[model samples]
Target: MVSEIHLSDDLGDSNLTVSDFANTLDAAIRTLLEEQSTGLIAGGKISNKLVELEIPEKLVVIGDIHGDLRALHNILKKIKIDKFVLNHNNKIIFLGDYVDRGLGSIEVLYTICSLKIQHPHSVVLMRGNHEAPVEFPISSHDLPKRMTERFGRRIGTEIYQTKIMDLFHLLYLITIIKGELFLVHGGVPTDLSNITMKFNEIVPNETGLFGDMLEEILWNDPRILPDGKDWENSRRGLGKHFSSNVSKNWLSISKTKVIVRGHEPCNGFKLDHDGMVLTLFSCNEAYPKFSVGYISTSGIRLHSIRNGFDLSEMVKIL
Candidate 1:
């Protein structure tokens, strides 16, 4: 039998070899398949698709890291100094796309997994478009190719199966903070209320059990239409690009203040519909500039990590 999930000891220690990763991958896959649960193991924290959080204290929200270990490390270093950010009350929410399109996909996965094991309740990892089980031909940089290049074909394939995509299914697609801020990998659905109740039913596997809704949540984008239209067909040929009015209607209906998402790698950050929607892209290599959002009692503050940590340009979304 696979050993109990215990990669928390490996955090900040990059001593794990590719073979070691393969072993961990095997164990994780066995754990996931056998348990048939959302948490890492049986009776663990987290559920499917939606992680509801109480954001009474400070919460650091990192946008898409892709696979840039450097940027991820930099953000971690800052978090380390803060000291209180990782406490039980607060949280560190990653807005997904943790793998693919960068050099350190495997390392990034290991790091995030370790952190999750260490802080099961405090650390939240959401599912991104790249996190889907099926291969995405659109990604310019394929993670599987990178894995194969690093550990050769056999070990790489094993890693991809268990260590990467399997865990993606366990990730919550939408994380609501204080029933106010909505966190999703992509834009929110036009009809947020209807889907919120049925989100757990939309589990994704190789066959895509609920592929259409999954595609919309993971692939959708936000747009501003001339009239007070709700949604329009996206140019991407995948999901709808919701209009400003759609977002407003959803926010009002859902009783949420703002919607935050990461997918388009939008020049580090983008605010739409008078800041009702915040799009943050945190991969520095793919997108040279990067920023992280902090949700607190004060409001949402966007801090730039481009040259260094600058909080002067913080935007209040409350």
Candidate 2:
């Protein structure tokens, strides 16, 4: 059974220390786990492969956060959905990479989890490649290593296991909104048609699952199709490299109008395959470019961040 939870508002504040996250780790984990259980039970399905959500009146789709709390906060506040805007009519779909590379992975996660607890039905969290543990020699800042550096070995390791690891297991691979939009951390998988998989199938608990469709969803990249092939093996060495033709087929099969994903960074946002796919990067410091997407009756709106976290004009994706 799922339980209701309340976390201190301070957990959502930026510029937090590892100790701050450690103090609230247990409560946050309990709440996140309960939310996952409740959502699964209420959804009438036991699966991790996908999560189906009804498109709310107003929907916001954010790209890779990568532990940038200031960017997250700025985007949320600009859209008036910060810590207090808990209206059920509005929904936020985060494309993942909630940790790694930035300084505030702990606080970024706490804020997201707190939002989930407060608005259980309104927020949808998707799994990203960086969510799981990466091996040594990887370039970016991973959760375990960064936390250990900040909080010492024992406390950091425990905090990671209790607060971060389980949440990664609980996250879904894809979210289908109103049967019109298909959302995932990465692009489509070539093996998506091989199995008679339900909307929600069980996914692997960790990354590095070679050839797993769920892993593909979390790792794939979109590429323009060449002469006659549908897809080629990905250069990333894990997921498949999908082409526009592949995307069209998947869109037709799934009956979704467009695919929105985040994995590769872009100049705020990028439209592909003649507007059938959108890749957005929401973290400003990720590469000095940032934006967020909103799906409304008016179409997809891309809000760019400028002048150190100020909101710019809303550019419609065409």
lDDT by residue (tens digit), candidate 2, 71-137:
7776666566653245655667788888888777876777777667657566777778887434323
Candidate 1 local lDDT, 42-140, one digit each (tens): 112334455565543556777888887777776676556235444666677788888877777777777776566545556677788888646554653
- lDDT leader: 2
| Candidate 1 global Cα RMSD | 6.5
Error of 1 at 18 (Å): 2.0
Error of 1 at 193 (Å): 9.3
* Model 2 residue 175 CA deviation in Å: 0.5
Q: List the residue pairs that clash in candidate 2.
A: 49-201
TM-score of each: 0.76, 0.77
